[model samples]
Target chain A: MSLLTVGSVAFDALETPFGKTDKIIGGAATYITLSASYFTKENNLVAVVGDDFPQSMIDDLNQHGVNTEGLEVRVGGKTFFWSGKYHNDMNSRDTVEVQLNVMENFDPIIPESYQDCQYLMLGNTAPSIQQMVIERLGKRPKLIVLDTMNLWIEIANPDLMSLLKLVDVLVVNDEEARQLTHEYSLVKAAAKIHTLGPKTVIIKKGEHGALLFKEDRIFFAPALPLEEVFDPTGAGDTFAGGFIGYLAKTDDISFDNMKRAIIYGSAMASFCVEKFGAERIMNLTQSEIQERVSEFVKLSAFGLA
Target chain B: MSLLTVGSVAFDALETPFGKTDKIIGGAATYITLSASYFTKENNLVAVVGDDFPQSMIDDLNQHGVNTEGLEVRVGGKTFFWSGKYHNDMNSRDTVEVQLNVMENFDPIIPESYQDCQYLMLGNTAPSIQQMVIERLGKRPKLIVLDTMNLWIEIANPDLMSLLKLVDVLVVNDEEARQLTHEYSLVKAAAKIHTLGPKTVIIKKGEHGALLFKEDRIFFAPALPLEEVFDPTGAGDTFAGGFIGYLAKTDDISFDNMKRAIIYGSAMASFCVEKFGAERIMNLTQSEIQERVSEFVKLSAFGLA
Candidate 1:
């Protein structure tokens, strides 16, 4: 099965309580492709970069069987750049800079090869761009998962809602879920969101864990407890990558299958936070992924007396 | 096995987005006793009330096999009265009024009949009071679980830390865990707290669920997804009750056993929020609890491909 991901391929400067990093290979698509690459050999990536973007990063994705044919690289423009400093909690962060470089006019064109992909992952991006990707696909993929933030909910709510109707699953953090549904209880929020469109909703709670809600069924996937969380930059995207990658590999959208997917996603995200940006996940191997998943199973599985 | 719980037994007036209730039977002991009562018939409750406290509420405990012989009813004093208003989120609340009538001079005396209890639960109360309960227990129980709030952490850090030295497990919410350990990550917080004395730490995250950390093993239990949360007043106490209650019945503190205990605690807490204060959990039956446990199994269990 093939997985298609659409998002930004850009640069980031991240500052966490543990340390700081200079320009690193970051962005939704970069993290997603790297995390999912461990589970599957075929990754169709649709993103926009610029002349300043390093060829080494693209080559790394290419080496991992990521099809960058759909990626648009502008000759004159600079790559999208973001800088953020995480607070002591590491759950909240302050955006110091958001330089929309080549991303300003990002018009993703899904190639024919990518169109045949069975799975679709829309990483955190503008609602219009995500909708355009869906529109460009000739046939609806078996599963479409969307990752969005509060900014889009505030600015492009209508457009986001329209896109939500087309997706099978919605992945968002707890706060974003609350903001979108205007409900404080995540269970209620997931219920209300299901009415909006998607049949499944995964609410990611950073270091705490992630929840998978489908119809009346729900599953909780705990993030592997780590003594030190150096950086949380790509944790969310990495989680999405692991989630969709597992689902695509299995080709199952049932609630039970999605539950396992959430655990796989959480396992990948736990590794993502071990290093700054996408460094840890980029070097992650299938054996490491399997080991983490086993740890998750131990963390959650217990026989009742 | 017998379970001993020490905390306040008072009257509460609460207002939430769902509705409001006036002068309901509340307090840590009330909720804890009721929740624990589900697991076993023997519960020794130690708390202070006053002449103004209603007999019907006391009778309610009697119905659940709660031995209130250790309860101190001040002849001339008034019952502890508390009133709080919950925010729309239900996770946070503001105390509008607090009248600590008879509780001001509460000197818990473990009755002779309750002294042989094998399990003890110290619900959220003054740090010194918690220590007093520990001192009053003639023989060390198989396990002792203590719950406290951020208030004690701020005003009685030294006392609280001293009290921690005697308990088997410490239960606190996520914020209190951070405040006590000075660690932003829950994983790090649990590690630091384990060194303080308690062999285990359970960090409660309200609707988000709870985490259990013991030695190097960590377990996550998700709260039941509810359609509505009428009140969250006694949810934590109820969780503590369920946890210790299960432990008392099993008489095992192994990491594996504690994981199941956490799940039972979570299941009881889910019922706690379905009605105002402790009403829902108070009237729950054995079959009802078993059914909820079955639901939890369904909610969290998934087969990996």
Candidate 2:
């Protein structure tokens, strides 16, 4: 099974308590594809970047086994650029600038080779665009996991709500979950969001952890407690990448396996926060991932009987 | 093994989002002893309450296997009274009034029988008083656990720091951990606190969960997500009690066993917030406890391998 991710593959400039970064490779699809590549060699990206995007970055993704055959390069167009300044806590950030030159008129063209993708990851993107990618698929993927932000849930809620019915899983931060469902209690908010259609709801709480809710079962995965978080810019996108990547590689969608996927996602996100953008996670060895996963086991493992 | 708890045993007026309660039985020791009673029948409570306190509450403690012979009823004095209004989120509350009547000049007299206690839990109280109890004890308990609040960290910090050196474990919420050690990262905070004295530090994060750090090992126990939180008063004390009670009953203080104790503590605290005061926890049957513990297992259980 292959993993297909659709979202932004652009550039970003970030300032954090840990220092600042110049225009670097940052974007949901970029991270998702890069992260998923670690687990599966057949990661395909369906994102549009302008000719201004560096060719070396694409070669970097290619080195990680991420296929960019479906990544459209618009000639003479500027790649989407975003700049943000992080507060001391590194939990919240303020957007300094946004240049959506290429994304403004973006169109995703699914490669014929990508038609066999069984695990589809719709990274944080416009609701209309995410749905368009899904509608264009020759056939529905075995599993569809969608991630969204408060922006779409507020201004494009109708479109977002309609698209939710077609996805198998939905992932959002805790604050976004509250804003989307208008319920403060995550347990209550999860139930309410279930009515909007995602059978599985994942509420990411940044440093706190992530919660997985479905039917009558819920699983909590704690984020690794680190001494310092250099940058949290692409942690969530990397988490989504790790999640679907594991699912695609293992080809197991049971609730139990989803819990394992959540842990893997958390482990990936933990690495993402250790460095600016995706520096730490870009070259994680299999042993490093296994060691981190073992730490999670020790962190949460306990027996009552 | 017997469990001895020393803290306020008094009345409280509470208002939550669900509703309000008139003067009801509430106190750190009250909740601590009651929660511990479910695990160990040899639970001993030593606290001063005014004659204004009803005898029925004493009988209630007796019915729950909690020994009240050490409880001092100061005739002509008033019971400690606390009133608070909970915000919508139930995480933060504003104390409207505090009448430290009998508690103002409280003296904990360790009953001759309580001297045999092997496990001691110091509930939220003045660090001076907590240290006094440890000093007066005939022999140091096998394991001493101290729970404190932010007030002590601010006002009685010197006394608290001295007591921390004598205790085996120290329990405080996330904020107090930061306040006590001046470290924001819990991992860092726990390390600094360990140098201060206690080898074990449990940082409670309310609804999020709790983290236990000892030696080089750390364990995280997630709080059971609830649809509604009726009241949050004394939840922390309940956790401490359950933790100590389980440790005493099992007579195992090893790191592995402490992990199980934390899960039990979290499960007990989950019940504490389900109703006003300690109503829900007071009547919990053994079967109910086992069921809830099972729920905790299910809530956090996942297989990665």
Candidate 3:
């Protein structure tokens, strides 16, 4: 099974209560492809960076078995750069700077080899751009999961709505869900979302957990309670990666399989927060993932007698 | 096994986005005893209310198999009264008024029958009064679960700390847990509270869910997602009631059993918010309870395969 991830692959500077990072490897596609690589060897990335991006990072993706032929490098432009500072709570952050040098007016060029990917992940980007990628695809993927943020929901809602109709699943945070639907109750918000587009919706609550809603069924998975969250950067993207990656590996999109996928996504996200900017996610062992999944099982498992 | 519940039995007027309620039969013990009655028949209630409190409510308690011999009715006094307005979100509320009439000098009188109780629930109240009830008991119960609000943590610091040492479990909402421990992360907050006294800590996150931490084990149970939360008053007390009630009925206290108890508590609390103060909790069938518990199981239950 093959998984295609489309988003930015760029640099990020972050400052958290624990410490600060210089420019580190980041971006939705970076986290998504890296996380999905663990579960699916045929992980393909379609993102745009600039010549300023490091070659070693691309080599690292190659070693992880992520196909980078679709990753475009602008001749003289700087890589997309974002800098943010996390508050003491670590749940919210303020973006200090963003320079979409290569991403501005970017065109997604999917390689011929990536046309066969069965699972598609449209990471957080302009809704119009996300739609463009889907339209340019040779054929619709078996499952399409789209991720979007509040900014787009505010300014590009019509486009986002149009994109929603084309995707199978929509992932957004709690606030975004409420803002989009004008509904305070998430159950109602999810129900409204099903009418707008995707049959499946995932509302992510950082540190609390994630809820999966489809038709009349619902599933909840709690985030691992860590002593400290070093950096929350890319945790969501990593979650999306682990989720679709697991689905791709299993090649099953049933509701039961999605439940297991949510757990795997949460476990990967638990690791992402342990250190700054996907550092922990880059070097996880299969045993660590298994143990973390087992922890999730123990954390929520109970039987009636 | 018998369970003893001690807390305020008074009146509350609430205004929410959904609607408003007049001075209703609302109190910690009222909700606690009512919820626990569904699980344990040997339920004992100890508290003071004014003669103004309806005699029919007492009869209602008796109908639910809750022993009210320990409830005192002062002929000249008025019942304790509280008023609050829930914000549109329903997660936060503003206390508009408080008239601690009978509760101003509530002295919990342990009855001969209650003295034989094996389980004790000290619902949210002044920490000093909770301590007095424990001291007056002829013998320690098999398990003691204490619930306290942020007010006690703010004003009765020493009394609350001393009471914490004697209880087997301490249950508090997320904000109170953070305030009590001065730690933002709940895992760290629970660990800090563990050092304070109680071996077990349950941090309730209203609609988000509840977490149980005992020894080195941690379990999570999610609050069932609802279309609307009619009223959130006394939800915590209802949860406490269901928790200890199930434990008393089963007479088991292992971590595994506690997990099931938490689900039961959450299920009962789910019912509490469906209508204004104790309205929906008053008449629930065992089948409905079992059905709600099954919803919880289906909500969080997942397998790797």
CA lDDT of each prediction against the hidden true structure:
0.89, 0.92, 0.94
lDDT of 2 by residue, A125-212 (tens): 8999999999999999999999999899889999998999999999999999999999999999999989999999999998889999
The order of the candidates by TM-score, greatest first, is 3, 2, 1
Superposed by TM-score, candidate 1 places the C-alpha of residue B93 at a distance from the truth, in angstroms, of 1.3
Q: Which stretches of candidate 1 lie over 4 Å from their true place?
A: none
DockQ of predicted model 1: 0.65
Query: For residues B215-259, could you state the per-residue lDDT of candidate 1 as single tens digits?
Result: 888888877777788888899998999998888888788888888
- Alpha-carbon shift of residue B173 in model 1 (angstroms): 1.3
lDDT, candidate 3, at B142: 92
| B98-205: candidate 2 lDDT, tens digit per residue | 999989998889889899889999999999999999988989999999999999999988898899999999999999999999888899999999999999999999
State candidate 1's TM-score.
0.96
Q: Which scores higher on TM-score, 1 or 3?
A: 3
Which clashing pairs does model 2 show?
Answer: none
